[model samples]
Target: MSIRQLFRMGMVTVALLGALPAAATTQLRVDLSQLSRDSDAVIHGVVRRVESRWSGDGRRIVTDVEVEVKEPLKGQPGGTVLVTQPGGQVGDIGQVVHGLASFKTGEEVVIFLRKRGTQAFRLSGQAQGKYQVVREEAGKPAMAVPEPSEALLLDPVTRQPSTVVEKPRTLAELKAAIRAALTEPAP
Candidate 1:
């Protein structure tokens, strides 16, 4: 082909390249099967220890949050969030909430947690994940739900997940919901 034609083709290619849209980013999709019936949502726990610099260059924030991951404190923390990934190895996790600072040594805390992928369902994402916190007038302080985005990760199949917490639910209201769930009758 002629030089002029070659030059024109190059310019057209450049123009097309410039018109391409930017690449899309993939958001972290946390496994939802990690949570439990109700208490396995998110809760706010105190920072137990901030190990921002894990096994290496300190790129990953490794903090330990105190919350209860096992039985009894299923939803909250009397436990800690450990570092999962670090040292550029993607060590399962990357940060932890070791409970420290502003959150006294033995202060109470709220957190959203679930079984660690490598542990016996021990809570991991103490502060690394979701869980909305609320104080009840009944003297029972705790959390109800996780961060809003978490609703999206609940059921991958359900394109439109619901986050409705029953605007005006009372103790009786909650009891009714629980009762209904229990009476689902093996469905």
Candidate 2:
């Protein structure tokens, strides 16, 4: 009931709220091979091409996509890599699945990608740019936004991202949890 007590309580609330993202940081520890399936994820890359094709059911649909590597996708061309996925969506739900629309050739955009199997990556929507495509070095693809370097709850971890979630209160403890989340194997 005292003013000092209320102020302390408010500060604690704010601090906890800020930690929510980190504390809730969940990573899917799937086998990198899982990247080869129809699984979905957010992909960042440039749009290289588009195709209007038919699905196995022979339904008329557009499969628009191109190659997009992860930011600094490691010793690879940083341009559109031909790809495709379903389109049309509205929100966080879209992030949860495939993109909401098809991409266009030469459009610099970030996509939420899913692997169609152990073969290649698929598009989830006609994604938008998550980074500013600026070439960091000559003779190299443009630079994209640096990934957050965190974890996704859907990442299929074999173990939990954090083991100390008994609720860490210190920065050091939180960081340890994050490291564990990153290194721990996913189921």
Candidate 3:
């Protein structure tokens, strides 16, 4: 083949490869009430350590977050809990799953967890299941600020995908809401 023809073919191959899209993940739509009802455990804690490792199948990356539980709102939990989330940086390789909850060491948070089996647990609604603990102002007590994952949501009212931004709620207010939901009879 001519050099010019080879060059053109190479250019086309590169273009096609560039056009290929990355893997996509979809998070289910879940309201506050649904998150509260569906979760197996609701925990308030501070992240103590985060470790990234490969899944058992060695197909994907997963992060193990060790959190020091301050309180357990739903299920009985000990002082510390290990929460697993998809995607993390291990060595030089990192896999990022959009809409997955990410935790940082020393960060305080409230997480809605769903148990997988005998020991494993996952976030109930990805990012919607996790809330960061932040103070409204200096000297003020901290509140739970939900991490924004609007792009990965489906509005319950509209039954369509849309962005829903939630305002920060005080710890007391959040706990009260969860308690109220817990009191309601299950469907």
TM-scores of the models, in the given order?
0.35, 0.35, 0.80
lDDT per residue, candidate 2, 107-139, as tens digits?
555433545554445533123212234445666
Model 2 TM-score (2 dp): 0.35
Give lDDT: candidate 2, residue 86: 45
Q: After superposition, how far is residue 29 of candidate 1 from its true place, in Å?
A: 7.7
Task: Rank the models by lDDT, top first.
Answer: 3, 2, 1
**lDDT tens digits, residues 74-167, model 3?**
9976788888888898889999888877788999999999987766678888888999998668877679899876344657677555556667
Error of 2 at 94 (Å): 21
lDDT by candidate, in order shown: 0.38, 0.42, 0.83
TM-score of 1: 0.35
Tell me the lDDT of candidate 1. Answer: 0.38
Better of 2 and 3 by lDDT: 3
